[model samples]
Target: MNARSLTLRNVNKSYDGVHMAADDVSLDIKAGEFVSFLGPSGSGKTTTLMMIAGFQHPTSGEIRLGERAIDNLPPHKRNIGMVFQNYALFPHMTIADNVAFPLRMRGVSKPEKERRSREALAKVGLQGFEKRIPSELSGGQQQRVALARALVFEPDIILLDEPLGALDKALREHMQVELKRIHKDLGVTMVYVTHDQTEAMTMSDRIAVFNQGRIEQIGTPDEIYFAPKTRFVASFIGDSNIIEASALGDGRFETAVGVVEARATGAERNSRADLLLRPEMIRIADAAQPDRRPFKIDTTINYGDNLLVIGKLGTQAIRMRVPGVDARRLTGSSECHVTWRSEDIHVIA
Candidate 1:
């Protein structure tokens, strides 16, 4: 199958003629790549997905599928497959018929439709459940059927809008793996939209983080987590402690805790900046170098795999994640020093 690229150029959508739902959003989704749109509600990810699916028209700018400008095309004419959070299956129809619906609508013959429907079902591990109705299947099974339906017509691209939101946590996690496997096997260009950070982190080749109708950053999972471009992207993608500080030049910053070293390549001296600290990067002072500063340990929470220690660092509350073994060694210590390498401190512009 030939996968086609999707492009949005300066796309903007506004309701009530003033506020923009998607502001100057430009993205190029490469053919056969899995990219995820991750953000909170009303962040314009869904609106952007709708525009790509031809369900919502952009107020201005261009949308192209491969070489053709598709901004004016109807949803049906675009030939894109879409999966919704609600499954959107025909409850009255058998699983086979539902999977064959798209092919039927395109005037496929009965024999070919049946063959393709069964083939799609087999892809989703639902080959034997074809005769059953949507009501007779479990949530995960129904979701698989929905995926089968979306893929039955062999679309050039597939758009999934929170397709796993309705399932339970364990089942949702299971489906994440399934989706990754399916994407790998089919090599179809897919654009997934979800509010779940873990889902995006686990399944996407790259992630586009959205905030307030604009894309804050777009990068690989590690880049988005360890090197966020903006404060919003840092706080949204994972747990982060953002500290306000003034740059002291020479890759250093002055904070309440003390003067700390950080990566501030482009930041000017004496300018205001924010430092991003991931809890896991900070180590207990005892386990690290002895020169690190000591802080009063206020409390600790046990998470089985790791211990989350919350404490005060020069009047500012901070958090550190210690490995279980290291946490056990400091069980009775009220004051423990914590330290992180200069490279671990991300100075957000």
Candidate 2:
């Protein structure tokens, strides 16, 4: 199979001139890479996927698969495989027939079609269930059958629009691993669309975060988690304590909690900024470490696997996550000291 690189340039879409779906979006995807478009509902991720799959035409700009322009090409002529939120399987056909449908449409020989169908089912760990109808299979099994059908065509790229949306949490997590393995083994370009952050973080090589019909940031999981570019990105990706602070001219911040040392970059000195601190960065102060900042623990919550310690400093309350193993040590009243290093602070103006 020939793997193709996809590129979108200044792609825009709108419906009824009131809903601006995608706004001036441009992205480049490498061959044999798994990329996900991730965002909440109405963020234009699905619209962008539809445009790339040739199901919906962009209002402007162009789409290129390698050197060939595919903006005007029909959906079938694009040679792309697609899996939707719904399985969309034929209830009347067995799993084998469903997988072989694509090959038959392309006029492959009956023997070759059967061979490919069985091989595709085996690839998805559904080898012996090909004789069962869609109605006879579980939700997860039906979803796997749809995936097998998509792969049986041997398309250059596959578009998956929340393909695991219907499964339970545990099953969806398992399928994420399966999809990653399949992508690596097949070496086919895959563009996945999902609003679930955990699923995107677990499966994608890189993710493009969408908001308000625009892409806010595109990076690996760590980059997006630790080095968010905007305030929106910082707040949306994970839980963070965003506190307003004043840059005290020399890598120091005057915050509501207290004056603390922090790292500052790409922002002017003495400017107003927001400090983002993850819950795990703060730690309880030790008496042996006398130089650590002091804090007063206000509340402690047992979260099964970890203890969430809420503390008060001046008028502000901060949260810290402590391991369950160490939770037994914090059995005292609401009065514990806490501290954090200077490097854990993320400053966004």
Candidate 3:
């Protein structure tokens, strides 16, 4: 596939002409890259994707495919494949015919259509399930048919808007791996929109985090997960313990618990800041250790492999995750000590 870069410049969409559904968004997606638009509902991720697909026009700004502007183009004219949440397969047609529909629309001959349709199905790991109707296939199989249809035309890019949302949890996870393998093999530029952070983290090369009609941050999964720019991004991406504190300089902060040692990112001395600590980063330690806080164990949840310890440090509630073996050590004890490395704490100014 000859993948081409997609660019959105200052895209804006306003429903009432007063409130923007997409607010001054500008993003550049590299060719052959897999990027996910991740956020909650009404966060403008789906809206931005619609604009790119020409289903919705941007209120203002340019939507470009490589060097050509496509903001004014119709969805069909844009040569971009789209897979909706519902899969949108034809109930009356067989699976092969459904996959061949795009080629048929493009006026391809019958022989060529049949060859390409089966090839697309094989690409999605559905080689022999061609004669069956949509209703006969499982939800996961139907989704693969939709994806095959999208890729049958060999468009420069494919847009998937929560295409796996209908599947069960186990199937959804299995499809995530399948989709990643397909993308890697085809090298097609893919823009996926979903509210599932775990999906985005596992599948995307870089994540564009959307909130309130704008992109809050765009970075690799590690960067977004570990060093979030805003408190919202920090809290939204994963399990985070947000601690309100005041900067004490020299990589320290004064909180309700005590003066904690943490690497201050952008907090000025004597100013208010928020510290983000991931549950897995904190560990059980001796009470006499430096940077340690006395934790009153309130509750514990065991997940077989790992356990979550919810407790309090002074008046604030904190959570820590430890391995199952470590959880054994905390058994029969209501109190313990928790400490984290300075680098593990992310300071949000």
Candidate 4:
């Protein structure tokens, strides 16, 4: 089935004269693409998703589904499928009955409803278990039933609001893969809302990082992780070491670690600056290398797959991630050299 694009123009919401939700948010979701609204609690991600689902109205804005205004449309008339955090299945009904409910509500013929229900169940790997009650299935299976129910209706768009949040870690990861495959196979426009960064990165075509009721940046996983546009984005996306510095003119800066060359795109000379360095970008070398700069190892923590190497450089404590294989050679209190490429330094003002 073909999917239609969704657009939100100047969306804003408030309660009791206080902005408790979205703020002038404008976003366009292309047809057949997967987008995620990712943020911490109270960041307005859920508020935005609810507004799109027609469960909550925007204080002021226009929501268009392929040029038709849907802001005033009721939830059922909007033709959008939704899967909630709770499975929300009918405990007394069988899986097939639950999946067929939407089609039945639409007045589909009995034969057609049965066929669609079976097909939807099969799509979610629940074909032979159609007669099982919700309580008879595991949590993951119950969630799959909910997904099958949502897809059986063949709505224009599917909105998943933390649908996998209730599952265990392993099950959650498995569901992420399954959900991605479903989206690819169906080619349906999907809007996923979650606070998990890893889930958003693994499944979305583009992620809109929300903060304080506004989108800080919207981009692919790589772009959002490596080229964050704001300090909040940098801190929120991943683990980063932000070093305070003073610009020394001509793309140079004096940092606590030492004087280092940096890319100064918008900062004025002599102004304060912040440089971001990924742990993997920093490397430790043998002190015997004559050209290597001096550094002191303070501590080492083994993390199975890798080691977190903490050291001191000119009174500045820095951390580096070393592969587990190589970490066996280094010991605490050993002197080492610390070096990083100039390109690896991300300078921010």
Measured with C-alpha atoms, the lDDT of residue 54 in candidate 2 is 95
List clashing residue pairs in candidate 1: 285-337
Residue 77 error, candidate 4, Å? 0.8
In the range 182-271, model 4's lDDT, one tens digit per residue, is 999999999999999999999999999999899888999988887788888878887777788888887788888878886546677789
lDDT of 3 by residue, 6-86 (tens): 999999999899999999999999999999999999999999999999989888999999998999999889999999989
In the predicted model 4, the residue pairs found to clash are none
lDDT of 2: 0.88
Query: At residue 288, what lDDT does model 3 achieve?
Result: 69
User: Residue by residue across 241-288, what tens digits does model 1's lDDT show?
Assistant: 889998888998999888989874677889998899999998876555
Better of 2 and 3 by lDDT: 3
Compute each candidate's TM-score over C-alphas. 0.97, 0.94, 0.98, 0.94
Q: Kindly give the stretch of ten consecutive residues in candidate 3 with the minimal lDDT sum.
A: 259-268
Give me the displacement of residue 279 in model 1, in angstroms: 0.3
Q: What do the candidate models score in CA lDDT, each in turn? A: 0.92, 0.88, 0.93, 0.88
Residues 1-349, model 2: lDDT tens digits? 4578999999999997777899989999999988999998999999999999999999998999988899999998898999988999999999999999999889999999999999999988999997999999998889889989999988888999999988999999999999998898889899999988898888888999999889999999888888787888888887777788877777888899888777856556678888888888877778877646666787888997889888767777777898888777788866767778888988875
Worst 10 residues of 1 by lDDT: 282-291
Off by over 4 Å in 2: 294-300
Best-performing candidate as measured by lDDT = 3
Order the candidates by TM-score, highest first.
3, 1, 2, 4
